[model samples]
Target: MPLLPALAVVLPLLLAAQTIEEQEWHLDALDVYSAQDQSRGDGVIVAVIDSGVDATHPDLAGRVLPGTGFGSSKGTDGTTDVDGHGTGMAGIIAANSRNGGALGIAPGAKILPIASADEKEQFALDVVAESIRWASDHGAKVINMSLGFSSSMTPSLVKAVNYAIEKDIVLVAATGNEGKEVSAPANIAGVIAVAGTNREGKPWKSSNVGTDTVLAAPAVSIVTTAPESVYSSGYAEMDGTSAASAIVSGVAALVRAKHPQMPAKDVVNALIKTAQDLADPGRDEATGFGMVNPMGALTAQFPPVARNPLLPEPKPSTTQPTPTLAAQQPVQPVVEMKDRLPFVAGVAGGTALMTGLLIALPAIRSRRREPVVSARDTPPTPW
Candidate 1:
């Protein structure tokens, strides 16, 4: 199986037992309710590219749009959850608790579930790539991928990711749960790699860390919706970087909805800029910019940038003929998020917004940060 296993242990919770306050501690950490008051993610479409999503779940009933699925014998319309993982991710992003059930961070947003992985939590690398392109062409503003491969990415997969970036789609992925290096897709340039944080506001012991990590969110004891058949109570408690990724995706929807005209790059910029710093001064592998601050992301003001902070500068062309003295003059390199630190620090040493216009900022990160490669033994065939 190329895809990572279910990121968390799914434990069924009694429907009548704990209230939302008792179960969803992460929401309070994010101040999601106040953020929602500003933007409930209306008019935004988030594509959940995962195992599958149970659209019929009470909390997700009318919130899921029609979607497509891949692989053999997976004749589902992207509305069925073979392993309940996708359903959980979808719940974390856009569950609508009209009937007093699980209330998601972006309750007004709609989900476009793409079922590319199989029941055993296995994903064909090609299928995942195809799904990314499909989502981009189908009008998805944000794509959430809770699954990842620890190995290097294939060329097609990388191309698919770049295509989405070019189309202005915000891509979010889990950094894996191994507590080792970050994984493919998430580690790919221009993608927002997310690490997991515990309830105490520290990095989760098992969330992978690396230069690619852009943000962290609560992944401990997350309460989310589940397929009725998979969990007797129609809800489950779990923990993993997968859940953290979904939390960021939900916040992204809110940002997009609040600023409908904001480019995808700026949407990403707002997230990284507004996050609470939880590690060494600035960005750190353990917690990236810090825990996601939903209220800050929504209410705080920040000047938009011409490029996504996560991306790197593009390399110059080599085949061009030798230029004249004036043309040969040195060209300024694109200012990357890391390289822009001095500018940001000079203004506000903390998370304050950077003012003034930044010119010639490259659109995406051209350098791909490849993690140490290793393959986990594949699980035995279910058949």
Candidate 2:
């Protein structure tokens, strides 16, 4: 019975051979949304449906764009990341990565990468309603659906998310870890859903609770970047609710980085009135409206997103190759470090081997109470 594994992991370490140990609790809960007020959404644009995004990850190189891709039989304009789980939920929402690790939670947002995943129904209603009407004719104020669909609410996906909240945008779906039903565009009604929790807060036995969820974050076990695996090469850990809808679409790109004029239903009513309730106190069915602080929806008291900047930029990103010395030879740093010098030389050689086993433990308890000291003494003769 030594071979079991349908799946099971406590996560002490070796999450399939290691790499991500930096657990500062989901970047200190996204630094409570990057410490109250600082939305740098400059030239904003966030489509990120899911199943794409590592567009050559140099921290989402030049902020990813060339988007578009509706799974089965439709890819075009790159970034379909080929199931790296929407490029690890688009590097946890807007990966403005600084070289190594992968940070993002609105790290200066910008990503269109659509790609809704396979088995078309036009990849769930006409390519997610032509990518939410092409992200409101291309000025995407925010969409981020981390993917989910079990069918049922088909009215062309509730008028394409009510035409993306009348083009106010925002969207952000994914409440289906198959905890049963409600995924079709996240139970409609303007869409937000989001679910899945972990890091002790619980609720994620395949997520999805009742009454159209609407909150909760930190999707279980998680980790990330697993599409290009040479068997755990690029990175991989994934759990459910598609990484809590990319951590509330990176807290809706830090509440569109800072009320960039608040729409999308006033940033979904300031993330359900600055959620964080938890422990099933004011919106049960498993931790909804509780968790997903992002500094309490970017300093609560909202009001800004009414932009009509004459919408345009529906395209961008590329160039940055020139690394051929057999791809810049140097290599090595595949992330290991933390050997803390072999745990300080095995805790000083286990404290000098337990002080020489407690000074030989009274000569091993006086040689087991010194009795038979010689060879079988005279006992053998009697036998």
Candidate 3:
């Protein structure tokens, strides 16, 4: 077992319940969790790439690991919680705090945190790319990314996700709070795009949409944690897909807990196909596969894996020799997300834009050089 990392820096808000019970409580009980529990997602490794989890929170204390941080205030012990967003996200995914047990989708799972808060365009791209590659190569079965860039795809991150897929890593991403443009990584193919839905089971007005979106989860009125300093308004009421994305990631973890053998993508597919229809007769822009149905996805029988009986005719080799694993050196863990944190946000348009731009300068320069390896190196499975 090694380490593999992935992340999302976009921190929107999520609606939370003060004491747990609310009119929309059952929304969090969607099949994504129960299915994983029924199937056993508790045994898997769910890497949370975000601001940094408050590992001391009663609900998530022991369940989270100080894997690494990608932001400036690097912690020797891994508790990099500053903005309060990461703690909230971690609560949704693996929080087991008693009373505050807040109870994650998969209670038995372990979380690996990769902390990074910088959000400039180039910095964001490089941090995300490095995080994904780190998690995949190290041994993360599932990588949860709750954020992404607003513009088109960055080659590095895109390649990193592609490499993760090759390694059979499952990637989950937030649909974005702005909702208008399809955010990078989420919009990219082979990666699972998770959108947000309110208690009424309606997609959040701000949640992004796309045909490629895999499923929508409870985004509004979702309960979680916040940094002590973040509550200038007092009691936190998170209200965005950021929370929903955590819920989805938790379910993905529980799925691995139940069925350790199933790869990340298949688990994602199960949830996608099993999702309950929320909008029209079938799939639509708002609710891709509908609210994630843990029960349905867990119990739903995946189509039997059938091998293509006849092999496709082989194409003639162009000219050069195909490199083998023996010829290539073993992939080394790339630590691109250390002190140089990618700008998480504010670079697009904000007073702090210059600061973000300055932070992103190094990452941009790194991109100018040859890619360390493929976007993400396909590390061997660690389970």
Q: Model-by-model lDDT, in order?
A: 0.73, 0.56, 0.59
Question: In candidate 3, what are the lDDT values of residues 62-91, reduced to their tens digit?
Answer: 777667756453443447565555666776
262 Cα displacement, candidate 1 (Å): 0.3
Q: Model 3 segments beyond 4 Å from truth?
A: 1-18, 21-40, 71-77, 119-123, 229-235, 304-383
Q: Rank the candidates by lDDT, best first.
A: 1, 3, 2
lDDT of 2 by residue, 287-320 (tens): 6677777776777785543422112222333666
Model 2, residue 57: C-alpha shift (Å)? 19
Which candidate leads in lDDT?
1
Backbone Cα, N, C clashes tallied per candidate: 2, 9, 46
> Considering TM-score, which of the candidate structures 1 and 2 is the better prediction for this target?
1
lDDT winner between candidates 1 and 3:
1
The deviation in Å at residue 370 for candidate 3 is 46
